[model samples]
Target: MWQWRIVGNGGYTKIQNVASGTFLDLFTGTSMPGIQVQGWARSASESQDWFLRRVSRSDVEIREILARDTHNAANFQGFRQDLLYLVLPKSVRDAIYVKSGLKNMKDRGQLFDSDDYAFFLKVEVAKWGVNTLLADDFGILWGVMFGQKGNHGLAYNFYLNENLDNIMFFDPYTGDEKVDMEYKAYLAVY
Candidate 1:
């Protein structure tokens, strides 16, 4: 009985409840890889019957009760792979890393490696521990909102650019200042 907004182009491209047999057009009706499956209204087509289970207050797990006769795409680019699960694209990951000063330090041999990125995120969160959850929540919402609203354009825009360092100081959230963990937390709750 949950409602989900469907994104992408194809046979399905609108908001519909899980009970209704509405299938997401992962390929946007075009032949592409990594097409995603989304819940829609029931059309009696077996594609819409889904089992929605609550995993946590802020998370839900969706399982398809009936397999719809749809072509599953591999490495599908824009569609959401899992419900309530945010996959950080390379661009978004890089943007966060660069903006948080992880990239610059890496070049200086001061901070290089995946561990550094993890530490950076952790330190950023610790600086504003009160807002850590909020920031994480905001990041999740931004990830999903961007996916649904712009077809992952925000993700790509922030993530897939050569001059990441150039815009590293630019914060897309406020537009006036570069995005910081504190700012992200503020935005998350507000």
Candidate 2:
């Protein structure tokens, strides 16, 4: 289903679709761990170059060697842990930390649904008055004008801000905050 050949002695390889002839590539301005790979025309860019690391006789890991590598190979585990701290809630983080034992900060952000993430944001905004959601994944498609043919171009959240907190939300529907008083005013129970 796929074929590849090394590009001379430059230590780069081009993987091709046997049926389509397109090479595996990282979309420009959007190369990071956990991001999806795409198929594009062959080029001399390093985004298309891959490093093959043989973990065992039968196991090999394909790594993309971009000009600016975000991951630190020497401390990969620590990197993943730090990523968890940036996105996960305190309760979920504590649970994963306890369950993982020596696993450090385990990622459970993907497990949460939209409502769950929204609720977490709601609670955080109420309790700490935080304004933004600091995230680890940079795969969001923003400002995209789809199906416009040459007029439409793709845009991504290649967040290069000093704080790196690109996504911010403010709840407009929620009314005044409620607190427990002497008399229990019970609303509709879920």
Candidate 3:
């Protein structure tokens, strides 16, 4: 049995079905112009990686992919793709894995429940004495739940917008290549 992992590469993704316990891989290591992608056993190299452009949405403005199906929880579940894109940095990811005693992003626990993980995410950033995230920075905050007036997955600005108040929040959702969110809805108070 192999534990599957989901990694965002581009318009497409490399994921192990969290529920199916299977890996989403390519048939083989074929780099031809047009090769099919499927699920298979884990390989020694990144042969399973692929790009999905035909089915992917065109409106999505991708800034970066934080992580893949990283965490599991009710509140956090809604933001896994967002959070994965948030905590995928090598230092930050290592810090969480070490402090939370998690071998990989699939591992879940109380620390990864909800707001707790968000807090830690912020703390990790502050640890480096960095504030005001850039486009590449996938910083998220535990803000007012939907219906209120804030965002839980506050991503960074992919590019400048005409309206100064409007900032773009990108989500690495498997369903959609990327989801554009209002930066104002994002709340980060730690």
> All predictions: root-mean-square deviation over Cα?
18.0, 21.3, 17.1
TM-score of each: 0.25, 0.28, 0.23
lDDT of 2 at 30: 65
**Which candidate should be chosen as best, given lDDT against the real structure?**
3
Cα RMSD for predicted model 2: 21.3
- Which residue runs does candidate 1 get wrong by more than 4 Å? 1-10, 17-85, 106-117, 122-190
Q: Pick the candidate with the highest TM-score.
A: 2
> Which should have the higher lDDT, number 1 or number 3?
3
lDDT of 3 by residue, 1-190 (tens): 5565666765556677666655666557666767776666655446766454321111122222221211212233123224312223334433433554322344244435434443443454444435345454343321221211243443321211223122223221111112344323222221
Q: Candidate 2: misplaced stretches above 4 Å?
A: 1-9, 58-190
lDDT value, candidate 1, whole model = 0.31
Please give the ranking of all candidate structures by TM-score, highest first, separated by commas: 2, 1, 3
Which of 1 and 3 is ahead in TM-score? Answer: 1
Candidate 1: tens digits of C-alpha lDDT, residues 73-108:
222223223244232334544455456654344333
CA lDDT of 24 in candidate 2? 80
Higher lDDT: candidate 2 or 3?
Answer: 3
Number of clashes in every candidate structure? 13, 0, 6
Ranking by lDDT: 3, 2, 1
